[model samples]
Structures are given as C-alpha cells and as structure tokens.
Target chain A: MNKEWPLWEVFIRSRQGLDHKHAGSLHAADAAMAIENARDVYTRRMEGVSIWVVESKHIHASNPDDAGALYDPANDKAYRHPTFYDLPDELKHM
Target chain B: MKNQSLIDYTLHLADNALIIGHRNSEWCGHGPILEQDIAISNIALDLIGQARNLYQYAAELKGDHATEDSLAYLRDGWDFKNLLITELPNGDWAQTILRQFFFSTYQYFLYQQLQHSKDERLAAIAAKALKEVTYHLRWSSEWVIRLGDGTDESKQRMEKAVEELYAFTGEMFLPTDYEKELATNGISVGPESLKEKWTDKVRSVFEEATLASPFKENNSAWMQSGGKEGKHTEHLGFVLAEMQFLQRAYPGAEW
Candidate 1:
C-alpha cells in the first residue's frame, strides 16, 4: 500500500575535488533518507569522503535532439583540453 | 583450565556474531529498498567477518585439527553459545530492525569495553569489531526512530516489535560461569553491569521515537536464557540446519 518513493541521483566525492561525480541513482522517501541511502549504496567501500543526493526530477537535462547544437561546438574546441598543451621537458611529470 | 574458559568465552562471542549475521543475511533480496538491502547485507558481512576472526582464534586454542569452518558449520544448536536474542527469527522489517537495534547497542558497549581486555588477541578482535558495531548501532537506531515515529501503521508495528524482542534483551546480560571468570580476570565486561547503560541508551532512543519502553510495564517479564550455556531456542535449530547443510552434505568441499 506504499507508494514508490522519489528517485535520487547520487554523487560521490572520492577525495578532494571541486565537484562530486555521479555514482548512481536510488529511491528514497525523503532527502534525509536519500543521503543515508546514498552513503550505504555508493560509498560502502571507502569510495567517497562526501556525498550529494539530488532528486532526479530536479535535474534538467538538455534534449537529445539539441545535442548537436549544445555540445558539438565544444568538441571542435580541442585547445580547451589540457592535453593540447605541450609541457616543458623539465615538467615531464606534468 | 584457563585456556578452556578463554575458548568458551571466545565461542560465545563468535556464536552471537555468526547467528545474527546469518539472520541478517536472510534479508538479502527482500529489503524494503535496494539500498537498504545492500546496507543490511554489508552489516551481515561485518558480523560474519568478526565471527571468522574469533572462530580462527578458537580453532588455534583447540589444536586437534579444528578449523573455523568446523567450529561454525559443524556445531549443533546445543553447542552454539549465541544469546537467545540473536537466534530469534527475523519476523518482519520492524522486528528485524528492532532486534538489530537491541543487539547492536549491546555489542557496541561490550566491544568498547573488550577493546581493553588483558587478553591481547581478544582485545585486538574487539578493537576491529567495535568499528563495525558502531555503524550497525547507528543504522539500526535510525531505522528504529524513523519507524517508531513515521506513520500510524509503522508506529504500531514498531511497538509490537519492541514488546516482543525486549524479553530476549535481558539474556544478553545474564552472566555465564565462563563470563564471570573472564570478568574477574579483566578479560570480559561484567554483563549485568552493562544493564544500566543499555537501558539508558534504549530509553533515550525510544523517547525520541515517541514509543514507550517495555521496561515500564514488565520489570519481571520471564526471560529466555541458556544460550550462553550452549542451549538455544527451537529457531536456532532451523537456522543451523540451513546454514550447515552444504558443509554437512559435502564434507571437506572447498572452492
């Protein structure tokens, strides 16, 4: 007789990072339960130092039909990638 | 004599872990949600891991080719010294969570004290097990709070769960002869001494959850015992029958 809870996208920060990467998704009754479920599901193996759970409904994704206009321009901007830079011989580790 | 008592005490701890770990595992693929399914299974694995360590140590004490598998898989109900609470059937989600909350709370305190035992290996095992039991306590207590306060149906179910399981809680503190000897040697915590703290912890959580304590009504509820002395309830027989099946059917089978 219980209704299905909301879907939450789980983001886990494995270490020091500016952003948490999407680990997976799960269903939880509320935001508090979402965080706890995210911890148990996505971070059981010392996988993350922090977790952020956002309801999937709250996320806005670009239409797949607009992918060409929204993303193709970035693909041609090869210089945006750090790999395009030539490191000095002394900075080999970089 | 000293070694025998140590082995007995060690098996007591191992049996509690093994039986409860097995009980928790019955929830696999049957949890209310997938995340909780994984969470409970992880807790089960932690308990079973603790049991493995204790069983290994016990095997070392008993030197006639006894192994962890033999101790865990070959033991009959009367040989298992797990407390009666651990062997009870996982009735419902409410019952499961409440049972876990009661036992894990006790284990958290017991392992905290055991971490300082004079026996070096037991202390080491307790130190490792304490970390896992801490999480188990938190997880189960949170569930207890949520269910007890969530909805009319949940509150009713949780109250029934608490009432049914509370009687078994007392047996966890009943001092066995081996435990008494170990207590004198600073190797085991005096079980009865822990009752006050256990009651306080349970009372505080129940209060927050808006559920009444069972202690208020039945201070003299008949308690089930004898598990520490290697006697157990009928439920344990079924648990062992299923758990010991593969090993019993195919002796010496291994991966």
Candidate 2:
C-alpha cells in the first residue's frame, strides 16, 4: 500500500536506430528500476540496444490551446521540402 | 561425475532453473505493478530458457531416445533434482524477492565457477547463462535491499521471509555423492566451498539493507533436504501437475 511510484517515460534505441525513441511509460521507484522495467517491457523482442528513462514531470509539452499560434504558420511552408534541389541522374537513389 | 553422475548434475541444474522459473511465472499478471509483472515474467522466461538448454544437453548425454520434452514433462515430482529451497511456495512479494535473492546469488556464483567446467557443454551453457543470472542477481538484490529498508511493514515482511527461507539454503551447499565426484574431477565446483563466498555476498547485502543474518551454526541438521535425492515437498507435486498437464494429455502433440 505504498504511494504510487513516480511515472517515467521510456525511450529505446532499437538495434537499428541511432537514437532512442519514446516507447512508453511505466511507474518505478527510481531511475535504475525504470530502466530495468523498460528493458523488460519494451525490449522483450530484442528490439533495443540501449534505453533511457526520464521522469514524466521533467518533460514540458506545448499547450493544446496554443497549437494554432505555435505551429499553424509552418503548415504552408512548401519550400521546406528538399525536392527542388537538382541532382545528377546517378544520384537518384538519394 | 562421469556418465550418470554428470547427467545427474546436469539434471540438478536444469531442475533448479525449471522449478524456480515456474514459480516466478506464477507472478505473471499478478505483480503489484504492471511493469514488474512483465519484469518477473521476463526473468521467468530467461530461467525457463536456461532450463531448456540444460535439459536439451542432458537429453543428448542420455542419448537413448531421450528428448528435452520427455525429461521435463515425463519426470515425476520425486524424480526432480532441484534444491528444496527452490520448490518452496512463494508466500508474498517479500518472500518471492528474498527467495530469488538467495537462489540467484547462489546461481551467480555457481555459474561463474561453472564457466570453467571441464565439460565443454557445461562450460558453454554456463558462460551463456552467467549473463542472465547476473541480471537476476542484481534485480533481486536491489528489491531485497529496498523492501528490507522501506517501511515497518515491509521490513517485517522481509525479516519473516529471510527467517523462513534461510534454513532451506543450507541444502544448497550439501553436495550429493555425484557432486562430490564432479568437484574432484574438475567437472563442477564444490558446492560446499561456495558457502563462504555466498555468506560474504549475503552478509554484505544484509548489512546495507539493515537486516540481520539468519544464519545459525547448528542449523544444517534442522534444515530441509531430500530434494536433491528425489524427495520433495507437497508443493512440487502440484507444480508438476499443472506444468506437465499439456504433455500428459496430448501425448506428443506438437505446436
């Protein structure tokens, strides 16, 4: 009947990934336990080479109410695409 | 420990993993937390995988149409050679953790020594299993310390777990005749000699956890035995009945 442990966000670097990706969340007593729990739950399929866990409280998220003000302007920026760049015929794979 | 003795020793190792792994699997979906439920299940799978490897090797050694499934599912409860400590019921979270601490600590040391076994298969299997057992040891040890130091109720539960499980531990060091032979032949390490190292490891962890050592000098005579000799508690019967039911009923059905 102990108080609920703190929530942690788990990130796993899959064997093919160069960076850890946010996988899921779990409750743990500490960082060490969080990492172990992450390994057991998220990497049971040989999915990851590394793991990182951060307290859920530590992550800041943008407010839903400000979503239009924060990101709507970027939606019309078609120049962000790299398709306009010219490339040699031999470089087509890129 | 050549031939039958070596086979017996291998079976002993297999049975330990199988029984304890079975016990841990009992925690599936029942853990206090969802993550730990998965955690214990993962450990259970590791142990059962180890058991499969050892049992498969044992089957090869037997070589008279013996198969891994047969060795695992066909054996009667009394035919199992796991330490009595492993067959005990999982009483509570504290008891489960403490039992795991005791067994995995011994396995950690045993596997480390076994990596150098004269038998190449045992050596290879031990080398592979040493990795998993190392994590098992760490996980269980951390929980033991956490629970022992956590709160009044937690500490009391851990203390009771230690007292209940400590007596069963002596049997791990009591070598059977075949084990003595294997130790002499360099096929396996002497279980009796591992006592001091096990004691040191257990004592250091206990000190950190602020728990008292439950060891008593004259406890061996009073400690339980006969599992290694094919005698077992009532618990093993129930465990086997459930574990072996599929094989028993299907009679060689394959998935």
Candidate 3:
C-alpha cells in the first residue's frame, strides 16, 4: 500500500500543431490511466487535440556533463548555419 | 406562465447538476491521489457549468427579473426537484465513484434523447451538455471497475457503496408531474424511456468489475423517493446552506 505508482511524461499536440510537445508528468497505475491523468492535468482548458504519454523510465536523456563535448563543437562551425547560404529574394519563406 | 411545466423541468435538471457538483467539490483537495483530485474537481466544474446553462434557461422562461444566480442561490431545499441520488452524502471514494457512475450513465442516455426534444433551446442545451456527460460516464465507469476489482479492502468498500446507493437509483426514473407534462409535449425526455439502456450499461460494467447487480437480486426493492417533489433528506439542506452562504450574505456581490 505504501508503494508509489509509476511516473509518466505527458505530451500534448495543440489545435494547430503537428507535433506533440512535452506538457508535464504525473503518477498513474498504467498507460491508460496515465493518458487520462495527462488529460485532466494538461488539457482541461482546450489546450490540445491529441495526447501521448510515455513512462518516465522508458525515456532516455543525454547527461548534462556531456553538454560541452556534444554541442560546443558545432557552435564554432559557421558553415553549419543555414544562414550562410544565399537565398533569392523571390523565395520569401526560405 | 404558459411555460410553467418547462420552467420547472429545467429547474429540476439544474438542481440535479448543482447538488451533485457541490458534493463532488467536497473532495477537491481530499482525493487519495493528486491526479484524481484534479479529475474530480474538473467533473465538479463540468456539472456546475451544466447547471448554469439550465438555470439560465429556466430564468428566461420564468421572467420577472429572475436570473441564474437567483434561481440557484436563492432557492430553498424544498423547491429543488433533483432526484434523491444526487443529494446523498459522499460516504467514501467508493461511494462517490459509484454514485457518479450511476448518475452519469443515466445522464448519458437521457441527454442523448433530450438532444432531439421539440423545444429548440432545450435540444441545443442537451446537445452541448451531452459531450461533457459522455466523459463523466467514462471516467466514473473506469473508477468503478478499478475499485470493484482491486484489493480486498477496495472490493469490500465498493460492495458496501453499491448496497447503500442502489435504493436511491430508482428515483431517477420516477418522473415528477412537471416531467410527465413536458414529456408529452416533446419538451423533455421521459425518464422511464432511459431506464433500460441505463440498466444495460450498468450491468455490463458491473460484470466487468466483478460486482453483483443489486437489481438482479431484488427487482422490487423499495426505493427512497420524493426529492423531485421537494421532499429531500437533511443532507441537501446542509448542502444548500453552505453553497448559498456567499450570495445570501452579500446579495448582488461580484468580484
């Protein structure tokens, strides 16, 4: 009876969105309950058209200690920037 | 007024929502789990929202400067026409879940038929409220199954709740005079017509939950009634006193 339920990470796709963004996390006994908890927690105010829930333990995250090695090398590479390419004025969105 | 029956019928529907919403709100911060706390609170809000719509419609029909707030906050317990089941105390988590499941199942079928009412305004309100009621039925049904089929303590508590609550379920289908009058004019859905569908849904859910249907054992069990005619248990008086305190203390007050 003292045991804690598993945690789930909630993702919500807003009315105009194609991707589900991380909303928050909650505790539930199972995946079905997790989705419902997410609905009550995150989407009560018409915030989303869709919901996705993943068990917290199933999600893998990069270590914060690897930040410099993983990301700093690309920072000094100016050519990696798409801004380096010239675009025609006629191609407005690009 | 020419629409007295419709007005009373609308008020009955409003009272049912408000009283149940008030009961559910009592669990706002006291739920066993935080997630469930929010879930019950959301359901309470939805019921209150439905109450507001029905009250507004009733007020319009009643005229004479009546408003939704006045209709809801100023009415006495004896004037309320909600079924007895809605005003019963929330004994425990199991009782609250079972009461919600029973009431929501009835509402699901009732509103589905009401959406086709000859009265355009009533039909429109029913159509809008049906979406919220559908979710209520699902949430409460899931909880009923979870608790009924859970550990021994949970199962025992659910059984006790079923026993305590079954006697009140009959009153939902016992139409009051206003209901009977409005049903004939197609302005209201007859409660009698929704009984079979409600029973089917409840029996199916009970089978999954591993709980025996009380109706199966005693089809002719004596049911406590009279709430629709304004004869309510003492519980509703207490509920109204607390709910109406603010409005009574400070008339016309607004934030």
C-alpha TM-scores of all predictions: 0.92, 0.92, 0.96
The segments of candidate 3 whose C-alpha lies over 4 angstroms from its true place after superposition are A83-86
lDDT of 3 by residue, B156-231 (tens): 9999999999999999999888899989988898898888999999999999999987776557888899998899
| Model 1 pairs whose backbones collide | none
Evaluated on the second chain alone, the candidates' TM-scores are 0.97, 0.97, 0.98
Fnat per model, in the order shown: 0.77, 0.92, 0.85
Model 3 TM: 0.96
Ranked candidates, highest DockQ first: 3, 2, 1
Q: What is the C-alpha lDDT of each candidate?
A: 0.91, 0.91, 0.92
Q: Which candidate is the best by lDDT?
A: 3
lDDT of 1 by residue, B59-175 (tens): 999878999999999988888999999999999999999999999999998999999999999999999999889989988998999999999999999989987898888898899
Separate clash counts for every candidate: 0, 0, 0
Which residue segments of model 1 deviate by more than 4 Å? A17-19, A72-94
**Counting only residues 3 or more apart in sequence or on different chains, how many pairs clash (N, Cα, C under 3 Å) in candidate 3?**
0
- Candidate No. with top DockQ: 3
